[model samples]
Target: MSLILKDLTVSAGKRPLLEIPELVLPAAGFVGIIGPNGAGKSTLLKALAGVVSHGGTKTLDGAWPDAGRIAFLPQDFTVSAAMSVADCVLLGRREHLGWRVTGHDRAEVRRVLSMLDLTPLSDARMDRLSGGQQQRVLLAQRLLRDPRLLILDEPTSALDLHHQLEVLSLLKTLSGGMLVIAALHDLTLAGRFAEQLVLIEGGRVHATDSPERILTGGTLDPVYAIRCEVFRDRDSNPVVVAHPAQGARAGSLER
Candidate 1:
């Protein structure tokens, strides 16, 4: 489940979106990709998932896994308007089924639906669900596949604080036997949950290490263009508190 990348580069037309000279991510842990907007965070995930065309090698354990072994949940996920929640989640089992779904696949679908508390909505149409509900349904769909490499982009964008914690907690538990990588906007949540953090800046990997080692103000101030402080909780985990950039604060003082 380990991932190794060498000379990886992604571009859109003439503009390069991501470049990583080398990176090795260990298997079986939650790795958080954190950066400001347009920092190529999403592109990095897409490259690893092979969602975008890129240069260089992205291999798992010295070879590539089949597409079915890797599951990707993009930031903007959409489904057909006519599909029910149960049918949508059941689709993840398509890779294993041959022309028809068996009882095992149906059981897995039911298990994940219950895990995500979607049993009540099993018959509901996906298009009519709330944003949070839809997000959970999509998550259940991905989880049912039991992918070896799970890639998620802004997975909790529409979830409330409660569901956010619930989903992260679930991923952490699920990562015991797989690699779960996500692009997260909340620095505090990323610091709190991810065992390893990959800091992307200007389409390059600025840092990759334990969250405690990289969440400091010195490491983040320039990338985010803000003045910030990093503290530790009772468990010694990093906690970030940010303020406006120094230049912005100075301008306000002058006024």
Candidate 2:
């Protein structure tokens, strides 16, 4: 489903954390939000998911089929110590059940657990899982809803390189008819997986375009405060190589 953010602003206590004049998220495929720390990337996602209060309109297209609607996975995921993995994932079906979970809901929970490679951990307590495994389990919970719009905040933070690729690949495969928006810190992985990229800085949208178009040195250098070299791979897609900021040149010796 398409998401339109018009004049969105978010405040935390006395400070404004996010301010977006306008943004249009595509109806399908993966979109990456990239920026430095405290750039309001996570805040943007939370605002769009209606988990936080913000000023502005976030509209999902009416023409688009709203099957399961929206699901959000935050960066810091926490579950009660007593809840099992299966039970946590089963919570995603709560909206459909209205009051109580049924046999059908349990079946869906099983399906999502298997789909996310969590079948083996179904009976395990969520507090006992590793960080990466916990992340996947939470994703499984979100997937149980079969949402049309999936918003994830820093989904790869706790994953190793191998698991990171695996999660991102799974996300790509799952984006066939859904919109997947993630706040990602790894620029290279973001470029590889995301069809489009949105760069934010100082609570403002600096640029939004295809990864090949927005990950360029000209756009990233100032925003990130680092020198970056942009090059093309064998496929002619953009690859960014970052370096430290340039230092002042040494004084020249007298002739």
Candidate 3:
């Protein structure tokens, strides 16, 4: 069982924003979308999540997916004030919720809140919470659903370093059960957590390979215009260190 895409394409007016003739994503794994800014990483995720209009034949397990069964959290997604944290997360279960709230609904909300360390502030208002806390609440909302596909854009963008590491670790663990796709800017971190990496360039997939293969200087230099080196850590994860690419200009990567 895998997510299959065929003839997928997105256009902004007449200029094409993204195009993927064919792609197959593993059913359960962490796949990181890695590329420079404006490389169409977000566009690709939005298309799969149905947040944007695009032309494509996207199927899960050879069949069309149920919209309600997919959980999506955009990078800049925000919520207004005047709502309790618990209530905000509970909204995620709306597809399965009845006219009356069920014990199961409350139980599920409690579970995700605990998973994201939000139970202590579950009663507080969403507007009163800190940015990191608010991000966690939104993530908890998405996790409350028993989704088959989980799509996120910069899932750790709002969190501090410690919390970012914690959430990435959790997402990696969860990917063992369901598909998890995220757009990551930190090459080292992406290499460490992602089982596979989709390297996007100029609105198309330049490469779909393991982080070890995609994080090398030879692979990234042309795309990012930087000179970088890749090494292994104690845990055998790829670690990337990059600098500005060399040219006739004043700024260049140092030796």
Q: Note each model's CA RMSD in angstroms.
A: 3.6, 5.0, 2.6
* Local accuracy of candidate 1 as per-residue lDDT tens digits, 1-255: 578999999998999888899999986689999999999999998888887899999887778878888889999976648789999998887767788778888888999999888899999999899988999999998888788999999999999999999999989888888989999999989988898999999999999999877887778888888877777778777778888896654211100
lDDT score for candidate 1 against the true structure: 0.87
Model 2 spans > 4 angstroms off: 63-68, 98-101, 231-237, 248-255
Give the CA lDDT, 0 to 100, for residue 62 in model 2: 45
lDDT of 2 by residue, 81-196 (tens): 76899998887777677677778888889888887777899999988888888899899988888888999999989998888988899999898878899999888889989999
In candidate 3, position 147 carries an lDDT of 77
- Which lDDT value does model 3 have at 104? 83
lDDT of the structure predicted as candidate 2: 0.84
Estimate candidate 3's RMSD in Å: 2.6
Candidate 3 lDDT over 96-184, as tens digits, reads: 78899988889899999998888999899998887888889999999988778899899988899988998899899899988999999
- Deviating ranges (above 4 Å) for candidate 3: 248-255
> Which residue segments of model 1 deviate by more than 4 Å?
247-255
TM-score of each: 0.93, 0.88, 0.94
User: Better model by TM-score, 1 or 2?
Assistant: 1
